[model samples]
Target: MKYVNEAYDFVNHAWSKGKIKKLIAPLEGLAYCTTVKGFKEVGLGVQPEESNYFNFFYPKGRFHDSLYGDDFPAEDLVSDCICEAVKQYIEGANSEFQVPFVRILIDLMSNPRFTYLRDGETEKKYVHVIPDDDNAYLLALRGEFLAKFHFGNKSDADDEYRAEFTSEEIDEMRKMSDLAIDWSKVNYESA
Candidate 1:
């Protein structure tokens, strides 16, 4: 929800056919935090060849691996933690919940619930949009018309809605995120 306002700004310009620039400053911070959190959650360097069972991407720039099949650490692959957070949030739930970080924030900000709630509504639905950054956007309903956007980055930048994981996996991700957020806060305070 922190990026909700910015998301709305981007959406306005996107719909109005205005120039939408990447908000790199906020993204960098979020990415760093997200990377740190993910590292803590799974313990990086612990497994260079382990099966991640999770997929991650670099939101800032493009990087490539020399080997085709070797599994690289997800953190090393991406710089945008917010992007990753978006991914984890909707990784496995309803196929309708997949999307990019930007659009989701915009929808949540534009709508009232301040989360993803379409004002005075009751029921869940999926909203999809293709962001300027070449990422697909999808949102899942939370409350009455209240939906949450989770990020999913692909090579072609295809803006398609698909169920990435099962409902149980989505729930597990939610629980993991709760811990990650608290971990981030504690570390921030200590710093």
Candidate 2:
């Protein structure tokens, strides 16, 4: 499928309508993406000349430098939390592929408990990542969940961070692509 267009549509829909949702950009093939994020807006910028590439931007504001430093807030996401099932597929991905895949992540606050999940042993430890109002229970760490999910380690060590998931993890992740972006009514390309 046209995963590139799917990735673009996912972020575009999020900005246009402000309908917060969960989007998991796949890393199976060589993907071309700017970056990805969750919860917040990624500033504003003009579209790129290349139809294969897209970069969204947020307005200049308080968190401009940190969040909007790039055309869009570059989360450097690998998309789809790595389930324990398939942790080998992405083992050699970095050396083999350099495509930029992505996913949005936010540390869901735990005070209210309503927005957070605190039921199981595993669920209670990490910060709950609902991703949207739908309450899709994706767990995140108080620190960098992406690093933990991607590399199986939260440390910033280059080798550790670049570590890949098992083959089963990669297969499961491929099937787990979920970017609910609908451009049914809008002329997305022109807009």
TM-score, candidate 1, is 0.20
Candidate 1 lDDT by residue in tens digits, 1-191: 34423334324336332222243345444323332221112111122222222222222222223123233433333332343434343442246766564665444324331122232232222222333433443323222222344544454244333223233434554465432322222111100
> How do the residues 1-191 of candidate 2 rate in per-residue lDDT, one tens digit apiece?
23223333333334522222222224322122442222223222222223223223222211122222234222222122221101222232345653222221122111121121122212112111232322222211212122123212334443222222233433443355462222132111100
Residue-level error in angstroms, candidate 1, position 165:
25
Instruction: Give me the overall lDDT of model 2.
Output: 0.25
* Worst window of 10 by summed lDDT in candidate 1: 182-191
TM-score for each of the candidates: 0.20, 0.14
lDDT (0 to 1) per candidate: 0.32, 0.25
User: For model 1, what is the error of residue 18's alpha carbon versus the real structure, in angstroms, after optimal superposition?
Assistant: 11
Model 2: how far residue 31 lies from native, Å? 9.7
Query: Which segments of model 1 are wrong by more than 4 Å?
Result: 1-22, 38-52, 55-101, 104-191
Q: In model 2, where do residues sit more than 4 Å from their true spots? A: 1-38, 45-68, 72-191
By TM-score, the best candidate is 1
